[model samples]
Target chain A: MPATQEINIQKLGLIAGGGNLPAYLLSICKDKGIEPFIVGFDGQTDSELMDGHCHQWAEFGAVGKIISFFKSNDVTDLVMIGGVKRPPLTQIKPDLKAVKILSRLGLRALGDNDLLSVLKEELEGEGFTLHGIQDFCDRLLVQEGALGRFQPEADDWIDIELGLKVSQEIGSLDIGQSVIVQNGMIVGVEAVEGTDALIDRCSALQQNGRGGILIKTRKPQQDKALDMPTIGVQTIVNAHKAGLAGIVLHANNVIVADIKTVAKYADKYKLFVIGAPIDKKSKSVTERTPKA
Target chain B: MPATQEINIQKLGLIAGGGNLPAYLLSICKDKGIEPFIVGFDGQTDSELMDGHCHQWAEFGAVGKIISFFKSNDVTDLVMIGGVKRPPLTQIKPDLKAVKILSRLGLRALGDNDLLSVLKEELEGEGFTLHGIQDFCDRLLVQEGALGRFQPEADDWIDIELGLKVSQEIGSLDIGQSVIVQNGMIVGVEAVEGTDALIDRCSALQQNGRGGILIKTRKPQQDKALDMPTIGVQTIVNAHKAGLAGIVLHANNVIVADIKTVAKYADKYKLFVIGAPIDKKSKSVTERTPKA
Candidate 1:
């Protein structure tokens, strides 16, 4: 993973999509005195985030125009951030460049991660170096410890372990990155429904007594340059609303949009938010104890 | 898989839980002129299913009494049928026999399948041969071919293939039995919430244009004698209500609780219900075309 100091901030390009992540990244760029060239997608990117920032708006399939916009602005270091609802292929009217890229991807179906990786390769081929959100702001990366005042108990650890195992298994298949486990039983696994909806759906299904815990991790085959599992203050609020006891995320492999606010929300809801150092092979926490 | 002819119907025992499966099995037993000794769970089993039947009701944790009830009735073959909401472990008051059985299960956590397999072994050790519902009535098993007028189009088949692949992957991990796929993206996967809830949750998340298809299969590590994926008229109705185009189930491996009614509902709702002969290793349908 490239640290902030190693990356060139000059002529940075932000491929913004929906959600607070784009806005959060914009704030970080502003703080560093780097006004990034922003590319916003129609209906997907929040327009408010691009206000007063050098940016271009285009349809999701306008690959040719999107690339030219970044190239003309001398933007080489690019970061794609935020959520984009995958539209049906029929609805996307791809330009010549996008069509060529799609053709190179072949007729076979592509999972979400696969599509992102292919897009990353295509962008890199166009002479831009793709970077993960962590490249600009490493502080957004979750560290190994409990973020809030609360800590997971012994039984919660067991559920967290099971959740990590299941999350990795699903992630390896390019399925999803989050799973809800309660009392050793997986209550729900997120697919295209996203994390918030997954939390909402699992609330009614949780077994009686102790609440479930949400576990989020990066896919084993995931290209960090393309995407990484992310959470924010909204995630904490949703987890708390779902009656979940806490949330466990893979340390250094997930992006926390607003760390301070997230921690404050977690504490307010009496929920433990911990980042665990995960062993990729074993899908287990490398260290059992949380740092004080 | 044992056929209906091979299994002896004499002194059959039906361990009934909740859902239409219990009552359906009971009706089958009556039709076969065999008055099965039925053991119903107090809260889990519907009392209506036990009316006018030779049955005894007990709490879910009354392992000793449940065994003696079957043993004293001279029930050599037992069939555990229907759905049971898994209660928190702390709520269960294990009897002496259950305590011994639980001890034998060891201290490690067990998934639903593992727990069922362990219980099957314990019962077999107690001189009762456990059989799946298929043993009593193989007609309930879904056969290869479309069950209704509608047939899946090319796009739907592609989605079905994707669904099967994901379903098998999840199943191999003992995670889920069903998956919903639309436009090459998996919308949802069933976990502890079961298939119905999975469909309902995916309904809102489905992409625009065509609706998704539901694919169900037996878990790769699943014990057929212990349990198999079972769907009924309610499943068809739910799929229809969820805006699903069709349902593809693994033939022979999945049980159709009431096939005729399910087919009727499928046809009435303009939904396709097909059973494909699945190659478990490849997780692909062996026969592609629907039988006329």
Candidate 2:
């Protein structure tokens, strides 16, 4: 449904990935007045998003086609959302462009962060501006303070302190960015399995006991646009299952889906929620400005 | 099959609890020298070690008897090895003396390090010198180098950097003592489940096309005799299973079990066994003497 007005939308780009995030963004944009162009990834970056948003789409291999589409359509302000979910290197058969990216990254002595940064640099050098998910929605960003009635105790603060230090250090290494710390000892840290498993195992470690704290953050310099750390309803559910005492968001920098429902869920579970104050000693994966 | 010259082995005191560690320690001590006095933890400490190490052992509630046993006997040096696995708060039927000691540790603390440190202090206050596992075996103190023919690669050095930084920060929280980094990204960090599980998971992550490297160290001010970092044949085996490229241990400070076999296994798997050179950055957890 292209907008049929003097301002009829015909020029936009949607760098899509395997998530509802891009689809939602593109749908909203199309509904308003713009037709979204698409740049998709293989094995990731949802295919259905192509139906919703692509004036021209790539099979992750067709980078040249994606660039040509955007250039021909006079699309500017490229918004890359979601991610290609780190492909299975052994099975990947990249197209020439992706092959170039991969071989360059592999050969340039680049680690994960180095590769990511250089990729961002290379893309920008090709006239694409980097835009984070925050550019779309304001409510997605977590706010300050306990979102619900459950208040944190001093002990929770201690665990938060301990969890933050551990999480940040791990995050800086490009590992998963989350840790379950109970009474200043980490019960679990996320490996490749992700956060839910970490929380699940922590419950077992706690022996169904109460008082565990879950801290989730982002990896350092992990291109906020590429991988904005997110927590959602499943997080609250996991916290309840894990007997976690509270949830601490990195003030305003992190993303949480649906605040009201999450707050209600926390209340239902009697889980304490605190918007951790960011100061010199404390920093989340995204270091939000210190709360006034 | 007791020692030929048994000197007052009648008053055995086994600080028994949890896993094969204390059990093995007890068996060797009893088989070689005198019997031991026992101390059992209901939930965390394994009680079965008592059967092998102690002449007579009771359940967890026998704190009074344990104190009395130490008092009655001329036992001086106390060994605190193997972790409690879990602190059995539900089984706390403390004697007056034990109750007094418990009162000193207020709430807001459940970390293993804090608990162990407090226990050590209380025992020392009562004129008991807390000893480590090293008191039993001189050879267990591993030397700084590859135990096998395999040497670490340049990439392994990068992983070591990431691993050391992350592990030290985790240690600073007194949360965990190990982190697995591969290709300058963390694959796992040891929380409650010890290093073996960490090794296996990181390896699996790599087998799924993610690389794996492991780092293990101790918290600063940690009583080395208690849970001094150890690696054994099982560690090498796990590393091999996980497809780990290398392991970076703190030089000279770590323990590698069965050096000859460990080296052979490492060589078989083409694994790199390295003792990471100590630098100022690695002292995040505790103080270290710069060696020649």
Candidate 1 lDDT score at position B275: 84
Which TM-score value belongs to model 2?
0.81
Q: How would the docking of model 1 be graded?
A: medium
Evaluated on the second chain alone, the candidates' TM-scores are 0.93, 0.80
lDDT of 1 by residue, A45-132 (tens): 8888788888898887888999999989888899988877767787888899989988877654357777777778889998899988
For every model shown, the clashing-pair count is: 0, 18
Q: Highest DockQ: which candidate?
A: 1
Query: lDDT of each model, Cα atoms only?
Result: 0.84, 0.66
Error of model 2, residue A107, in angstroms: 8.1
Which residue pairs collide in model 1, if any?
A: none
iRMSD (Å), candidate 2? 3.1
CA displacement after TM-score superposition, residue B138 of candidate 1 (Å): 3.0
Who wins the TM-score comparison? 1
Leading candidate by lDDT: 1
